[model samples]
Target: MIRTLQSGQQCQVRIASVTGESTLLYSTHRILLEAPNWTLDGRSLILNGDGKLWRLDITSGTLIEIPLGGIPDLNNDHVLAPDGESIFLSANDGHIYRAPLTGGHAQRITPDDGSFHFLHGVSPDGAELAYVGIGGGDFRQPGRLMTIASDGGAPARVNVGEGHCDGPEYSPDGKWLYLNTESFSTEPGHAQLARIRVDGTGFEQLLESKTVDWFPHLSPDGQYASYIRFPSGTQGHPADLPVAVVLVSTGDWKTPLHTWPLFGGQGTLNVNSWSPDSEHFAYVAYPPATQTED
Candidate 1:
């Protein structure tokens, strides 16, 4: 469970347990939590706050700050390697770094050639990494999805075209790469969830939504795909609210197995990581605020 607090005119995040029957998991104050990614063992959480990486131990309720070496300016969306040994994080300097999970120096994996690269997912075997590379000098321009070996090699483009692609994740079997494609438009801005073969063929659309839908994560069991869905009519503003987490069946994308409300809306409430058992997922939820008259 997550909670939100009112900080003057803004909101902050607070982490709690999902079980409603337990009062021990509740928090009396809200903290600035964002972009929570789970360790492979589900015993810890990795999140970005204060422009730095933090590891939280669930059992001990301790928060340990991890230094990002020389690379700073990493937003949320940092993923832990499948072995839980290393962390892949994207820096504001247009590069990706691999660092030890226990807090040490981070080695620059991707080149800082002024092209933006965002780290999204690591293969279950920890051999490959899926990322989105934006063209031009800035990341806001058009981009495509690409995958490269963890040891560093030639990156292969999995999706190519004029459409903007973001949030790439690999299936549990490591056969398919899931992502969201957004065409530059103001009319509804259709964003669809898609999957492509690792070999860069057989691209297929799994789901479509009028509002923005991204951050696709395949459950550990390979049964469901969980994503964040922003409701229609709210776009390109801080007033936008994440409505729910839509869980779609892997075999059939037409139907949703479950939909849960995010409750809080101001802060980042996107789904970033899943438990190893695939039963429960972790997300950051901020407290909702009273609506003001326009």
Candidate 2:
């Protein structure tokens, strides 16, 4: 979907410590930034705004746009490849594309199938991509968890039951794909955290709660995880709502290591934002700009 920064909304990019501290890295009312991926070198972050990609240097606090010769506007779903030099992007055109991290022409990966590919994860070895496929580009159809060869070929479906699913990411170890699914509940829009083996076995829910949870991003070390939590009964991670970025130990997701409350959702923590060192992760907030007195 095309996302525009609504009037009076300011985008704030903040880095949070796993231990419970958050630092504002950058804030701007000019553009709407979403879904940050920390660079391998830990020097900068890659985010998409204004239908284009941008690089934010954490230390220097500088923002630069990364131009793509091909491919349409991008969605929040983008994953950095394991090689650290390549990236996989989900464009508004309903196909996936691969491009250089530094910016260049994009190579389309998914075929011109009837389905729309929304990318979320690349394998640890960068051999495959896990994404959600909406058949016939139909939003009414449940998103099916799918995987395809990184270079592009016939996509394979990983049955996630009858319910809709999103954010199928590979574990750091590459053994499992983590995501959120609504199969566990019959209620509409009630997505919960879960994971299944890459081979489509061992499906299990990570935790249960009345609150709707979407993306489950694991740290590089595989010891911790971070996910977005919405209010109970909220339908499909929407914008401009009260949400929380919850951090927890992978060993026990039932307990939260830290919870950072904010007035943001959707683009806030959509992708895996954990820093390479696992000490920090990035997220965005879009709290409306308070009016100034005349």
Candidate 3:
């Protein structure tokens, strides 16, 4: 329940109920803990830390590092397969790779050559994977929302817009794709959560905010959406500000049930994965300023 990071710190992260009772879920000594994805059975958590994917057993409190092998430069948005057999991750090398959960070789899934591919999530059926691909040489330029069959094939663009589209994920039923679009023209960059039918129809905007709200991940039951809400005034540098884990009712996008502030110091919180039961999620909290010995 408590994991001591290698830095000699005791369990720095603790989970408590709304009443403040310790849930004893995780306590890690690791300085950088990000992208915690629970296995399908909920027995283990897969997290990316120290530039590698680690499998932590909940019961035994043992940590095993999954060898990515040849694949390097993995991002935070890796996803586990529906059956929990394999995982799909994004490599900074401009490609997507699928590797076994137990550790083995990794196979490339995208041939994007350029640094246009940004990984998102895999569908519940494991048939398709969604990602963001920018056409212009500069990543700041608006990108495209794309989806491809997991087996490897030509990817298809889902949205046509000038604003950069990113953080694509599928509804629990795989009926719709949820993503965020950031338009430069809008003040503070409007963050729009849109739903696109899998068949590529009925592209509708579900929610838009003047403040940046991205990383839409549907809860396991598919009833609520847990996403990151960047505080206002931190537009272009969202990665450098604190964030809140907000929950929105899927049935009604206008209603927000809960919001929890995270990484309060002058740092940033990058939320990556959600638990299978949707009870708890994992994220990385970075400290902004460090003391230097004078």
Candidate 4:
């Protein structure tokens, strides 16, 4: 349920529920991990830890290191292809990459000159990837919602004029991509839940509020969306804050059915973590900020 972090505190990773209860899946020894994806088979989970990818066998309690040949540092920005044969990830250099799900050398997808690249979603057909990139602009470097071919090519900006767009996950049919875009507040980036088409058309706001919202993940059955919410006026999704994972019906996108508390903020739910059946989701919560010396 909980493991000691480098900070000498218990770090928790939970398989969260929409309504009733949530249970702990796995934990590590002073090694905090980010992002949790139940494999297509539903027997194991894939997560990034200690700057490399790890496959945690749920039934056997074994951990196998997934070999990413070239990238020495992996971030929270990673996703499994829909077919579960490929992986798309962002390395420390802020460039996108693609590697086989079985694990091997990674081939670069984005230019090496960029400052930040976060791989949020892979389309159903595995032909396109929606991600966030900071660059392509002058000083101050704003983030953009962009999609690129899985074979590696230039990224096309998805929203025409939307500002600070992040977390782009595709609809089950691949027609719409859900994401979050920020508005101006007393702080710099205050996010909202939204969606757009793959062709960069049909840009519409799904949920608008004064509170900061991010990571809009659509269910596989096309009925609901799960996302995380931070307190109003929070500049960004920072760590160790009082946060909640709120579920909303896709049609209304306003009223929430459940609100679950957490001790994490940034790496809690950065990627699409819904189960194959689309009934449950996954999220990570940290130890308190006060603990540090494991």
Candidate 1, 144-225: lDDT as tens digits: 7878788777777775446777778888888888887765443544556788888888777777666666667887888767
Q: Against the hidden reference, what TM-scores do the models get?
A: 0.83, 0.98, 0.82, 0.89
Best of the candidates, TM-score: 2
- lDDT, residue 50, model 4: 70
List clashing residue pairs in candidate 3: 3-27, 4-29, 5-29, 5-30
Clashes of 1: 2
Write down the lDDT of every candidate, Cα atoms only: 0.66, 0.93, 0.66, 0.76
lDDT of 1: 0.66
Candidate 1 regions exceeding 4 Å error are 1-31, 183-188, 233-242, 263-272, 289-294
Clashing pairs in 4: 7-292
Q: Candidates 1 and 2: which is better by TM-score?
A: 2
What would the TM-score be for candidate 4 when compared with the true structure? 0.89
- Candidate 4 stretches with Cα past 4 Å from truth are 1-6, 113-115, 136-139, 160-162, 183-187, 289-294
lDDT of 4: 0.76
Candidate 1, residue 23: the lDDT equals 17
lDDT per residue for candidate 3 within 68-129, as digits (tens), equals 78788565557888888999887666778899998888999887545467677788889999
The candidate, 3 or 4, that scores higher on TM-score is 4
**Which candidate leads in lDDT?**
2
Q: Count the backbone clashes (under 3 Å) in each candidate.
A: 2, 0, 4, 1
